[model samples]
Target: MTTDGPPARRLMRWRNAVWLAAAVLFLLNFVQRGIDLFSIILTAIVVALGFAVEHVETQTRRPFKNYLRVALASFALGLVLVAMPLLMGAGIWIGLILWAGLSGAALFWCTYYERTEPR
Candidate 1:
């Protein structure tokens, strides 16, 4: 069966906070260019942390392996994003699109294969 009530409510609150933080970071990146490297790194770390938080909040168990994989992916993506402007001489718009697409895919993977321990 499904769960309901306080626990679910708390989880929702945590999820909202994470999403808000991610959005704010993304917006900040859009408005500022001097800190592109820092922003990219911070965004990746934030996204990874958010995923870990969601996993813990939902499953009540820490999946270290999955977390490590996500962290590595985030870092690698961030590096690629940081290089896009220099490597391709592309504008921030293109970089943002790529970042968004990559981030969305990562989030989707997390949701699609959420951990569930055996009884």
Candidate 2:
């Protein structure tokens, strides 16, 4: 079911905070270790997806906007992960492919939810 109100806003804030924390950790990992950490990248990807999926706006829900947001966030996160020195070349292609697939899936999900959701 769709959600809004204070609880959803709180959840959105919490998710964004988590994403920021994960992003900070990711940057620090690179700076300190001078190398890419797979785990940190994975954390970032998960955090980004989690934050995007919260869909916390109080106004009329817009699935297309959500799809765009998810797509951009996924691409940004995927770009960061694959651009690391450790995972280059094939990783670049893989990351882009994954981003496209994820965006498409998110669009499908958002459309489906919009139709099935109680209005």
Candidate 3:
């Protein structure tokens, strides 16, 4: 009387195996194609621009020119970061490391300036 129940369980197992196989195939495709840089560059630019806006709000009390100056500087820096790999023939990992180093240096400089400047 329970034969139909066993068939349902068997079908469920096969369905799970098929789903797992499809998922594995999808993952392998991505591993083969490698990561892309365009999205990364766009993300970096947005973040840098956001930081520039924040910096202008907090650090610069001057007119709109100062805001433009800070924002433009940050944008230029981000552009250079995004172009480093193409310009230097560096791999993605090296470009990321270079960007990190430059960002760290900029952060340090800002920290020092904030401490030393009159509030």
Best by TM-score: 2
- Candidate 1, residues 1-119, lDDT tens digits: the string is 76676887877887798699879879876687655776677677667766765665466544555555565566667656756575566766666678778877886676566655532
**Per-residue CA lDDT of candidate 3, range 28-98, in tens?**
75577654675445545655665675456556664443436544655566567656566667666665666
Q: Regarding lDDT, does 1 or 3 come out ahead? A: 1
- Residue 80 shift from truth in candidate 2, angstroms: 4.9
Cα RMSDs of all predictions?
11.6, 7.3, 18.9
Instruction: Quantify all predictions' global Cα lDDT against the true fold.
Output: 0.67, 0.65, 0.60
lDDT tens per residue, model 2, 1-119: 76566786777687678778877887787788776567666666666665555543333256656656666666666666555533544546666666678767876887787788765
Task: Please count the clashing residue pairs in each candidate, in the order shown.
Answer: 0, 0, 0
- How high is the lDDT of residue 40 in model 2? 63
TM-score of candidate 2 to 2 decimals: 0.42
Candidate achieving higher TM-score, 1 or 2:
2
The estimated TM-scores of all candidates read 0.37, 0.42, 0.34
Ranking by lDDT: 1, 2, 3
Q: List the residue pairs that clash in candidate 1.
A: none
Comparison by TM-score, 2 against 3, better one: 2
